[model samples]
Target: MCGIVGAVSQKDIVPILIEGLKRLEYRGYDSCGVAVHQDGQLRRARSTSRVAELQDLAAQDGVAAGTGIAHTRWATHGAPAVHNAHPHFSHGPGVDAPQGPGRVALVHNGIIENHDELRAELKAHGYVFLSQTDTEVIAHLVDLLYQGDLLDAVQQAVARLKGAYAIAVFHRDEPHRVIGAREGSPLVLGVGRDEHAGAFFLASDAMALAGVTDQIVYLEEGDVVDLQLGRYWITARGEVTGRFQSVVREVRTVHAHSGAAELGPYRHYMQKEIFEQPVAIANTLDAVTGISPELFGDGAYRVFKDIDNVLILACGTSYYAGSTAKYWLESIAKIPTSVEIASEYRYRDSVPNPRTLVVTISQSGETADTLAALKHARSLGMLHTMTVCNVSTSAMVRECALSFITRAGAEIGVASTKAFTTQLVGLFLLTLALAQTRGHLTEEQEAEHLKALRHLPVAVQAVLALEPQVIAWSEEFARKENALFLGRGLHYPIALEGALKLKEISYIHAEAYPAGELKHGPLALVTAQMPVVTVAPNDALLEKLKSNMQEVRARGGELFVFADGDTRIESEPGLHVIRMPEHYGALSPILHVVPLQLLAYHTACARGTDVDKPRNLAKSVTVE
Candidate 1:
């Protein structure tokens, strides 16, 4: 994933562009750069480093302009180098200029499928490519098509593109003008208000434009927007005519979390997000007075009643949340549920039933694979669709018939913490709603579940209190290169999430397996050097999980267990136990995952790894 922020404002846009890139850093990037129209010429500075470094470089170069475009790139077509970084330029016919600052400056967020063909065509037209990037091809094409108007050139350039892209382009000749277009990627137009009324902005997310603007226009598929100092215009592609026409898009007021992105007391965003879970869960469930289908959407009751089975589709941590919900839906709602990875589901053949409700789970809601899978399921006649998403204005919410918006605030860490737990809260609510519709949830059962839901925030707070103990465990874990996680029943998905967190942040080779499968194969890999972490709840699987713990100990493998209070598992040689304050019954997974997050965070800290921006990972997966 990449981030784009462009602005046409009266003030010095360099600071705005750099600050916007800083806010977008959670999305992940390898290199960053900014291009500005300064004194009748294009001035830019790029670096293969963090956005903070790029900011310093821009300041050192005195790169200031009232109109500019900035980019934080996670490389796809080229290596992570200064030349491959964006705000790529095309010098056009003036290839022999002193520094070749170029005429067109462009920043792109997605991929170009036919860049090879376009690169060949541009080379034939005497356009030289400096950077080895698909984005460079677009810049050349835009410069080649420029016939005096920047907007027209960008529109014509995008018309020839063959894949997903969201681009912000500016021409040096066109002062105070920036043109943006989105096809498959996400783009938003921020209309500045009050003191900043004369400014206009385009960003990959509304978070990038926080404080500067609260009003956002989410560009639809194939929409092009031209931003000027005081005004903006939008044009949408006609489906039948295949031509762009002027259109009016709704500008919705968005209250972005301007302060949440900051790291206050915590060492990293991952640590801050882990500690923020209790508040995040409370905010996500703030509107729940009682469980009802209307908690999802207007026609959720009708959709729940009509569906026979549930099909859950998601990617990464969202998929694991879906996996946990499968147990809840089957046991509580008496509905057969199947969870599928969105990327694989979209490319494979599957039986899609119209009576089966397809539920999509995503934090950003703009996850490209999950969005494509939702459409694929629709193509197979699965009409009933629902989404558990964090962003209310995301494409997934707009595409689904029903949605539960999680109020996880802004998850700045590349490794998700609060967002994963909040998604489980949404999914559990969906399960209760479906159970009510199916006559499985009685009045008494509903009341008890509601009470548990109300106490969840406090339960999570207690779990967070165990961070000191988890930190001690992390010190030992930091020395190991491999880890194994185990769980049974509903907590098995929690184990998977724990392993994922450790691997993602700490760069350890971690694997998760159902405890029952240990004897079959995983036992061979258990040794004194390997750390086996287990989620041992006081449920029916407790005895079986104890037996699996014995299996690990017999193989000389050290065990770290997160056990419930009632479980008599004590801390002894070769075994370490961290007891829970109480047993949460059905909602135990949410509480159990907190310490695992702490373990990963502290372990990454001990190892001196990048806890917030882990290597080769991004917070939001907007591309397939």
Candidate 2:
């Protein structure tokens, strides 16, 4: 979970790298540094706060540079100190090389899974390393592998390396060119006319390159780019490959930008994102007409149709989304579905085999654990691998045999608001596609489902209007340190995600349980001091959730209920009820999840936490 950017230009590139790093700091802010080659000398600086401070220093009047690489790091190997920051350098072969003129520096994203082995190999070659970071291993490895050609050295080093990585390296000899490679993490190339007028930039994401220059080149998973003085292109080794070009869209329309001035005037990104639910849902519905039953390919029907069992793999919030999706995949598709956390899926002795349809969910395309699981499943010879992801051209999408794109737009909030709901929308649509293919749902049923799906946006709007209510509810939870969320059937997973969101941002010890599981264990945690947030959508499980709420009430625990308008479920003495608009079938979960998200967001805000950048968490986990 780090950010890397590189630029090759015929003119000074200090300003460009500095601005790019500021935009990219959201990816990682623990530590940052830059390496720029100027006047036949390579200069570097690193710091721990934000990228702007040192970057501002790097762009001094006389600090003219033609080529440079920058990185904002999220620590994995060492602590988040200046020493562990990216643009890590070594004179000759180690970090403490005595500040010499001739030196090499490297910036990296993703993990070097076999760095220990590589480090031992480098040490055997008499390459003394300084830093404790796994990244230092790569820097030395590149030096050992560097014979004459810089591009070839990077290529050979990457070939010998194991696991996921996006790397940018700079050397004194090859000061005019910036070399970059991507395996699991994202790397996009920004193109310009020439170095004088235009330059090519390599960044972790499209947003980092926004407004600088939009002419973009997207790198394929195994492809590497060589950005020389005047031109750049991707290559597998020496063979050039075609680049994936995309248009740059404005960050937001002028009206949406101005209207969302305070981000809906919410206190934090979490709260703002909560209020964005109605628009997010509306956009999802507006963009999707209906998935052509054959959206994947010709054999899609054969793989998806008449499935006997299903397996779902994902990490974090996406895993919770999968948990809720299991209910619909089983009930609607009439298929037995088992949900597995991606990190643990392959490690366990399990059999998904050839019959099961494995679906993976991820907000960003590059979740390290989830990607590892995807690769392991591929090796197991699982033929049908599908994904539901927000990123269009992520590693996960490229690897999956079939995929659905979630149109949630950019989710800057690390705690994830729209990503969860958009995933639900995609999964619900997938269920409909599978049911129709399996002959479980008729034309009338499909039509009714679509009609209900169309109304989801309106239902979400109903929930959005209750923000003042949620804001008021936030006060009651200000002093709370623990909470329990309960739901049954379709919403069981929603409860889990709700609890996860609250704990993620608020640092509250929250646990979620299927209302059915309460009698078994979780009920023991309920007390007058603990708040119980229950998703009580009016459905087959509504009565069951109602009974569970009574169980919580019996223990004198506080209750916060979100139910449909007609359920007539009123708030009990220590309980509070927030009513939702009516929607039937699979659509309710998508609507029901909106309020729970808001509750967690408001609670976190009331408790005064860094809602955007939560403690000890990364927006995307690029290393397992």
lDDT of each prediction vs. the true structure? 0.93, 0.77
Each model's total of backbone clashes? 0, 0
Backbone clash total for model 2 is 0
Models 1 onward score TM values of 0.98, 0.90
Residue 556, candidate 1: Cα error in Å is 1.3
Query: What does candidate 1 score in Cα RMSD to the true structure?
Result: 1.4
Candidate 2 C-alpha RMSD relative to the actual structure: 4.4
Clashing residue pairs found in predicted model 1? none
Best by TM-score: 1
For residues 1-624, write the lDDT of model 2, one tens digit per residue: 688878888777877787777666545468888888887777887788767677666655355687888888888888888777878765554543544644567899988889999989878877765567899888877877788787777888888888788988888877788888888787878776533454778888766666666566677777778888666767764334433332232222111121222344555666676667767767776756765556544567778764567788899889988888888878898888888899998798776577778788999888888988888877787768889998776778878878888767667678888888888888888888888887888878888888877887777787788878887888887789999888888788888888888898889999988898988988888899999888887787777778888888899888988878888888768889988767456767777777777777788878878888787777878878
